[model samples]
Target: MTTALVTGASRGIGRAIAVALSERGDRVAVHYGHDREAAEETRSLLTGDGHLVVGGDLADPAGARAVVDTALEAFGGIDVLVNNAALAPSPATLHKIDETSYEHWDQVWSQMLDLDLRAPANVSFLVARALISAGRPGAIVNVGSRGAFRGEPDFPAYGAAKAGLHAMGQSLAVALAPHGIAVTSVAPGFVGTDRQEQTLAGARGEAIRAQSPFGRVATPEEVAAAVVYLTSPQSQWASGAVLDLNGASHLRT
Candidate 1:
């Protein structure tokens, strides 16, 4: 059976991706940054047995290696990887250029770039090398954000990191093609995940939903559906693509 590792699977979109992978009969390695309890809960939601849970602080380069090694050790090899772990744009990460201090700006920028961009780069490299050595075709999908194109006024670092992620996926797609490893990314707009529930319930909820003609934000399942496709063997031809899941809210052109 194909085995998958979904980083940040402790909750929200990551958890949804893991569940979808499991539903398709793939064994999953659910990874969390710092929440072992939540990661275990994700394992309980999977459809099949043999699903594993791993935890590590990917911001540290060594942690990325540890995560991949743990998953590889348990599953023999990882056929799919969903880089869904990220430091999203919460109040903690907010750094609007105008109102933020230099020290806060540096802190947020460094934290976001390290975890959201650098971590994925390291993990992708490690996983790609493992796949090449084993001579197995595999898929890597990065969960990007529309903010990369639409503009994250409040979280510029988040936008920049995601933009870098998309570019990295495209570059890796070309680099890994000869080895039969496909790479792609999905740029989603505002999604209604558990982490976003408070935001969607607050005063700005109406404005956020109004951004799309559908008058609603996307669901975690919607993003998970995209991941499910991107990580499948049938989607090999779709490598190098940065599919936009913004509900037509932000069209790039």
Candidate 2:
């Protein structure tokens, strides 16, 4: 049986990914930042047994290590890793230039870069090392953002971090290919997760939906479905590839 660890699985896209992985018979480790109750709820929504709920503030390097270590010890070894945790853009996270103070700008940039980029790097390192030691071929998928390709004027740090994440995945893919490990990323434009309900219902709802020709935003399950394929055993050839999940909203040449 395959064992997978999914970070930020307490809710939103992370929860959906966990559910999808569980339904496909892989033992899942659901990692949350500081939401044990929500993680347990995700654990409940899972399809099968052997699912685990882990909590850690992954922004901290030590916390990232602890989460991966616990999962590795409990599962003996992990075959898949989804670095889905992130500091998404919101009212509180927004730091636009000219309007925001220098101190606030520095704070947002530092926090976003640390949690969104460095933490994933740390977790990937730990899990990849574990898989190598175990002599196991595995997959690591990162949930990046379309903002990396487009632009996040209000959240420049987020865009930079995600772009770094995509590059990091490609680099890891090449480095781990000889060991039979694959690394990939999915860049979704605007996902209508539960947390975005308020924004989706507010003034930006129509404009957000209109970004796609389908007149709708991507769903968490849709993203999860893409992950299911990328993380599957047959997709080893797709290593180093970054798949776009936007609904014809943003096209990259």
Candidate 3:
């Protein structure tokens, strides 16, 4: 069975991806930043046994390495890695130009890039090296954001970081291809997650849904399903691809 490591698996899209991988009979290492309880809930929701819970701050290089080491210790080896952990846009993280102070902007930009871009790159490095040393084929799926293409005026850092993440995945895909490792990324638009429920129920909800012809936002499960396929062995040929899960809300040429 495949041993998968899913970062930020405590909730939302990360939880859904963990569940999907577990349902497919892969032993999952659910990594969380702080919420151990929520991570345990994700572990309990899995379909099979042998699931593990690991917690660490991905922004810190040492913590990121420790997370990978913990997963490796428990699972013996990691066959799949999902870089889903990120500092998403929120009221506290919003830094719109002209409205926010330069200091605030710098702080938010640093934080977003650290967790969203650097963290994933570091984790991928550790996992890819392990797979290579063991001489085993593996796959990596990065959870990127559509904001990288459509832009986020209020959270420019988030958009830039995601763009970097997608580019990093392509670079790694090419670098690791000779070792039988495939790396791909999924850029998802607005997803209906617990964190977004309030916004979806507010007055702007209709306008948000109207962005896509389908008249609704994508669901976390749908994104998770795409991740599942991208990380599967059969999808090796799809390496370096950046799949869009935006429901046609945003298209890139």
Which of the numbered candidates is closest to the native, going by highest lDDT?
Answer: 3
TM-score of each model, in listed order: 0.99, 0.99, 0.99
Can you write out model 3's per-residue Cα lDDT over 138-175, one digit (the tens) per residue?
99999999999999998999999999999999999999
Clashing pairs in 2: none
Per-residue C-alpha lDDT of model 1 across residues 151-180, encoded as one tens digit per residue: 889999999999999999999999999999
Per-model CA lDDT versus the true structure: 0.95, 0.95, 0.97
| Per-residue C-alpha lDDT of model 2 across residues 1-253, encoded as one tens digit per residue | 9999999999999999999999999999999998899999999999989889999999998999999999998999999999999999988889999699999999999999998999999999999999999899999999999999999999999999999999999999999999899999999999989999999999999999999999999999999999999999999999999999999899999
**TM-score: model 2 vs. ground truth:** 0.99
Query: Lowest summed lDDT over 10 consecutive residues: which window, candidate 1?
Result: 190-199
Poorest lDDT segment (10 consecutive residues) of candidate 3: 225-234
TM-score for candidate 1, please give it. 0.99
**Candidate 1: where is the Cα deviation over 4 Å?**
none
Residue pairs with backbone atoms closer than 3 Å in model 3 (clashes): none
Question: How displaced is residue 52 in candidate 2, in Å?
Answer: 0.6
